[model samples]
Target: MHAPPAPPEADMLRDALELAPDARVRPLSREPLGSGSVTGLEVTDPRGTAEPGTRTTGVTYFVDTSRRAVERETGFATGPSEAPDARVWLHPADPHLPALAPVAFADAASVLLARLGLAQSGPPVFVAYRPGRRGVVRVPTATGDAWIKVLPPSRIAQIVGIHSAFAHAGIPLPAIHGWSQDGLLVLAPAAGAPVAEALGDAEALLDEVDALRRRIAAVAVTHEARTGLKRRLDWYASRLGEYDAAFGALERRVRAAWREAAPTTVIHGDLHFGQLFQDDDGRLTGVIDVDTAGIGVPADDTAAFLAHAVASAVLTPAPRDGQVWALARAALRRWDDEAGRAQGFRARAATHLLGHALGAAEMREDERAAALLRAAASVIDQPAGTLGAT
Candidate 1:
């Protein structure tokens, strides 16, 4: 079943602050973090301001989408008995609350950069942020422009290790200058714009992605790497909440179809053009955001790339003439030919596309969103080669 709407913002704030009645909280800012998950708030306290200019700390509220309940600890951790850094869980009372908090990220970036000796006089510009997942910022350093990344404590090692392995395997990656135990990483920028910018040049995009796939495939799927859910089925199962009964059925059907054994390789758990950086001259510069990288069937990454292309085309007006769409289809076909698992590729892509449609529908209620949802449904049962054929 789908979760209920979020709670009220004012009530959440009142409840959260009530826990620390003595501490004067000046809310700096708030914004939405995606995945239908938690929201972040940047708050300042007048009492015992820590740094010279830094007065705010980030408060993240975890939303249990399945229960529509905010956890209790964070909600109540602000009392006089609790320390400033004590974690708390607070449930929001309404849907009008802030979804994301940039100030918190700004503070974090500032502190981490200073520690790394990469600090600049100016503030860091945010590239992306998700409350509990990750935060990315672009800042200047002595050597050159660098990126500061903050991720969940659990993912730090995997990300660092994967980048090292990819580099050793001859796959391009951003240079990792340093990382902290707290999940903060400093990196040198990868050359060129994202692959999404060059999707119109089908030949270049295909050649680059194919080469990327081959190199990644060369890495053996280690036992430790495959520790978690080894298939996309689990990922698909987690997203069925937004769709209707028909989608749920389609999901099950796709899952059943892929019961057979399939070839496995080191797959980019989250593959999309945004994750790919490419040069203007038809070459891949690097791959970023490997938080979900793991051992999986080759079809997983291919499906993810195609799904995002369709979602992008559906949501935007550019990449017209079906150029990007055609290129994505061709790429998948080539992979299937080489891997001998075209059917698996098509099936998994179909499942992911369906989820993307549901997300689009929920996120934007416009005609474009509607069209994409319909497009996804129409191709749900079709072969992978037939995707975006319309």
Candidate 2:
């Protein structure tokens, strides 16, 4: 069994507004409290119990740079309505769980039911919400009706940009009717199964992803201003340096990247299976989470795609949904063949591999970290690739 966290950890260290000036405290539950699971304790005054009246459903708490991490595992939850303070809440389940949010707001997901008016209601289930990227919710819309989405793009210009690309491609994606700067997005749910559950074979999924890629390519912005050679090297070095001490050789590797001549292109910076939606009949319907779509090196898209590709491999039990090396190679090959960049895919893939490698090292799974390092090592020795060898 895994060891328990230390005592007095309290989990939370500080609050943004000092608990909004002490009138509130970051709500948290300890391991001992909830069957060894640290759930957020959303309470009312005087008494607490989990009943229909006392039980709060359809609520989630978001913990980011902005909110306090009251508990190590769970953070602040959304009350009946969105708020910044500790108040009485009646949340059905945690929004941190994918399907929880969708289920909670099933009544409010008005646009979804109307769009698929003819279809049967898919009881969308909540799979594990991938932590680092976004909380994903998988629902059954029709036979496979479902949707997968990131909260929103507040850090960068990701969501709006991708939504526009969907429109340009004539692809049917979720309609972004409501969005907040903090990444809270209220989108029109898609009618399909999560590609994760719908597709039976990786080969078929890859083909669908490839076709989807080409369609998006039509509307891709080609005139993106490339950073000059000197500027590029400096930028690489600066970020590498900032990350080097933690990464070991990243700083040195970035310094050498200055000499490489890599081309750039437009891509959905992050794309893969998780962003995809498929019908129960195996028809891939819509792909959401396109904000990372932008003009960058071709390999950037490949790396992002492979990130999900690798994740799929880890998530699936039997014959895995995909393998990292094969999927990455295929995505790269397609970018080079149809997208017009010969070396761009290789260079960007190498760059993405490095970034993903560093982050992967911190994962709890030793094998995952090892695999990421091995793949990244293949490219790291290339001037700009100086992070380290696996």
How do all models score by TM-score? 0.68, 0.50
Among the numbered candidates, top lDDT falls to 1
lDDT of 2 by residue, 1-390 (tens): 111232222223223112222222224322111111232332222222222343223232323322222212233433323332221122333333323344335554445445545243654444534332355445555534354444424332455666766687787688764444444454566658777654465456678877776676666555442323234233333333332344445434534432343444555556777777987666778876665565655545554565445444433455443343345445444454434233344344444544444334323344554454445444433332222212
Candidate number achieving the greatest TM-score relative to the actual structure? 1
Worst 10 residues of 2 by lDDT: 29-38
Backbone clashes, candidate 1: 19
| Collision count of model 2 | 27
Q: Report the number of clashing residue pairs per model.
A: 19, 27
Write down the lDDT of every candidate, Cα atoms only: 0.56, 0.44
Q: lDDT by residue for model 1 over 144-246, one digit each (tens)?
A: 6778777654567777888888888877888887886556678888867877765657656767776888788776436333323223345434444443444
Model 1 lDDT, residue 188, Cα:
80
Runs of candidate 1 with Cα error greater than 4 angstroms are 1-61, 65-108, 119-121, 140-145, 220-249, 259-263, 319-321, 336-343, 364-369, 383-386
